[model samples]
Target: MVLIDRIRYLLEKLLEVFTIFLLLALTSIVLAAVAFRTFGSSIAWYDEVASIGLAWLTFYGANLAALKRAHMGFPGIVSSAPPALRMALFVLSEAIVIGFFAVIAYYGYHVFEILAWDRLVSLPSISLTVTQSAIPISAALFIVCECLTLPEAWKKMRAGVDSEHEAIEEAIRLAEEDLKENRS
Candidate 1:
């Protein structure tokens, strides 16, 4: 693949690894927090740490979802539309989603800056800045992934299918058409 493709691949891989690590970390933290609370011992920072990890995990997972087209939507609407209208709607929806996420990424950057300067009172253990950094980082990554996915979606919308999804869709379409023709 080309440089940009390679970069995207690497980012995706890194995000995948980060998501798994964060999930495991969050799970462990939750279990430990439960144990501590049960024993009448409190770890003041556990909640904050878990929240931060969960936020990061969620953002990365959202990006992964977008990349895989795993984000939930009402498929029946799109599937029922005529092809041209469906394509237009698909492109429009993707554009709207990208624009919304772009705004989010912008605000996330501002939040990160503010966090960097401000300290959390309860957990002076880690700077609020560090915790806030994950927002912008994940938002930026999400934006990148959405942008990368748009063209592929558009291509699929227009061309019916491309190298990526063509084989499977084509196979299914052929089978369905054959069944219909045979029935007729």
Candidate 2:
């Protein structure tokens, strides 16, 4: 359990760092592209590189979200169910998601073979393999996150905690505090 927790925390921090880096890269690319275009000189690699950056951001950002347990869910409905059914549904959902991503990772590696000889349209020096690696990599990272958080998910589900409701309540409480501070 200690090892798992340590690994989970490490992955969480790593994903956060990776997602921020991707966001920064994407922002820099867009700003540079806009400036270049304003000067009547468009960059040839701008479009392709920006799209690649967006793809990487989406992939890595998803892993961060997964690790943080920030994905959309109606916890109220799940918590309202009977204990047995709640556990069953929770287990089933997790299984389906993990299995789906495993399949994606498997086929993603095969995609590598097909893309082996392909180069970027705007930059022939850059290989498609390098840019497209986010698929398998993100899928694997997601599985690791899901597994790490499974125990927490199970405990919350078993305890009949409506996580979404709690989150909304916390947000409201924080907003109220901020409003009070502003008034003071």
Candidate 3:
């Protein structure tokens, strides 16, 4: 269990770093494209490349959000439920999330396989599979993030912890801190 936790921690850190890099790269690409177009010079493949970068950014961002337990959910009923009911609901909700991503990963892989031979229209050198691969990759990453957090979530559920409320409070605290830092 310790080893698993360590591995999860490492993977989460790596994913976070990668997501940041992707964000920077996506921003640069879009900004560059806009600058070039404004100067009356346009890169033919800029739009296609930017779109692919956006897809990668979104997918990876979702994976990071899942790892951070930042995804939105209706927690009112769950938070107010009895301990046993809360635990049951938590388990059911997790199952749904995990199952949904698993199905997407499965189908996304198939889609990738089918489009593997195709190439991007504007960027003919790049295969469609390369961009489409983000779908399954992100789904798998999300599953891993959920699985890594499952033990802690289970413990909280057993202890009747209002995770949703806690998460909201945490977000508010972080936001306040950010505002303070900016004002300083």
Candidate 4:
């Protein structure tokens, strides 16, 4: 369990770094494209590369959200049920989510075969598979994050204190403290 927690911590930091890098790269690409166009020349790879970067961002961002257990969920509904039913509901939800990502990863892998001969229009040297690899990679990352955090999440859910509620309470407390400090 401690091992998993450590791994989760590392994964979180890695994702943060990668996502920040992607954002910076994408911003630079757009700015360069705009500067070139303003001078009466357009970049051929601007649209294609930017779109790919955005897609990768979405996929990886989803994985990060999963790791944080910050994804959309109805914690109130689950917590209100009896303990037995709540456990079942939690299991069912987890199964559905994990199953969805599994299917995505399975098909995403097959996409590489279909795209093997295809290359980007703007940059013929780069294969579409390279850019599209984020699909399966992010899905797998999400699964890893879910598994790593499962034990602690289970304990929290069992205690009738969902992370969402806890987060909200924490946020409110912090905001109130800030307000008090400002008045002083």
Candidate 5:
């Protein structure tokens, strides 16, 4: 359990860092495109490259969000539920999400297989598989992260670690702040 938690924390941090760079790269591409367009010599591949970067950023970001359990949900209703039911609902919700992403991860690998031989016309440096594969990769990582946190959750049920959701929410909040600062 300790080992899994450590690994999950490490992976979550690593992915968070990578996602930051991908976002910055996307921003740089967009800025360059805008600047070049103003001078009437827009790079032909800037848009395409930026689009691919954006896709990677979006999916990877989603995965990171999932790991943190930070994706948006109807918190109002959850908050209104009875205490016992609320906890049950939370577990059920996480389980359902895990199931959904597990399926996504499975099919995502197939998609990667189908697109394995293909390359992007504008960005040949990045294969189609690399882009499509993020889905499954993220799904798999999310599952691992959730699973790692589950034991701790059970341990804290009496005293309530709330660690899984709380930690994710905190991480997401920090990431959002970092993003805003970077944009500024």
Candidate 6:
């Protein structure tokens, strides 16, 4: 259990770092493209590359959000429900999310395979498979994140804890602390 927790911690941290890098890369690519165009020297592959970067950013950002449980949800009822009901609802919701991502990942793999031979027009050296690969990769990441939360959900359920509310409150508190620190 300790090993699994450690692995999860490391994976989440890695995802966080990768997501930050993607954001920075995306921002830099866009800014560079804009500056080049303004200077009357546009890069032919800038659009294609920036689009791919944006796609990757969106996919990986979503996966990171899942890892943080930052996805939007109407958990009001669940948070106020009885322990048994809350547990059932949480489990059901998680199962649905996992199943949805599983289907996406499966189909995404097929899409990536089909596009493997197709290259981007502006960047003939790069295959479409490379850009489209983000779908399956992100889906897989999301599935892993969701699966990792299952044990915690089960433990909370067994302990009759309002984990959803607790998590939300904890996030709010952290945000407040960060704001205060920044102001200081």
Top candidate when judged by TM-score against the true structure:
4
For candidate 6, the 10 contiguous residues with the lowest summed lDDT are 154-163
lDDT leaderboard ranking: 4, 2, 3, 6, 5, 1
Compose the digit string of candidate 3's lDDT tens values, residues 25-129: 988988888999999998898889888888898999998888877788766677778887887899899999999999999999999768978998998999999
**Poorest 10 consecutive residues of model 1 by lDDT?**
159-168
Residues 7-110 of candidate 5 have per-residue lDDT tens digits of 87887898899999998999988998999999989787887778778888887887677666566775455655667876787788778978988998899988
Q: What C-alpha lDDT do the candidate models reach, one value each?
A: 0.76, 0.91, 0.87, 0.92, 0.77, 0.84
RMSD of 1: 6.7
Model 6: which residue pairs collide?
none
Q: Which segments of candidate 6 are over 4 A away from where they belong?
A: 157-164, 171-184
lDDT of 4 by residue, 7-109 (tens): 9999999999999898899999999999999999999999999999999888898888999999999998888888998899999999998999999999999
Flag the better candidate by lDDT, 2 or 5.
2
Ranking by TM-score: 4, 2, 3, 6, 1, 5
Clashing pairs in 3: none
Worst lDDT 10-window in candidate 3:
153-162
Per-residue CA lDDT of model 2 for 21-51, tens digit only, reads: 8899899999999999999999999999999
Between candidates 1 and 2, name the one with more favorable TM-score: 2
**Against the true structure, what is every candidate's RMSD?**
6.7, 1.2, 2.7, 1.0, 6.3, 2.8
User: What TM-score quantifies how close candidate 2 is to the native fold?
Assistant: 0.95
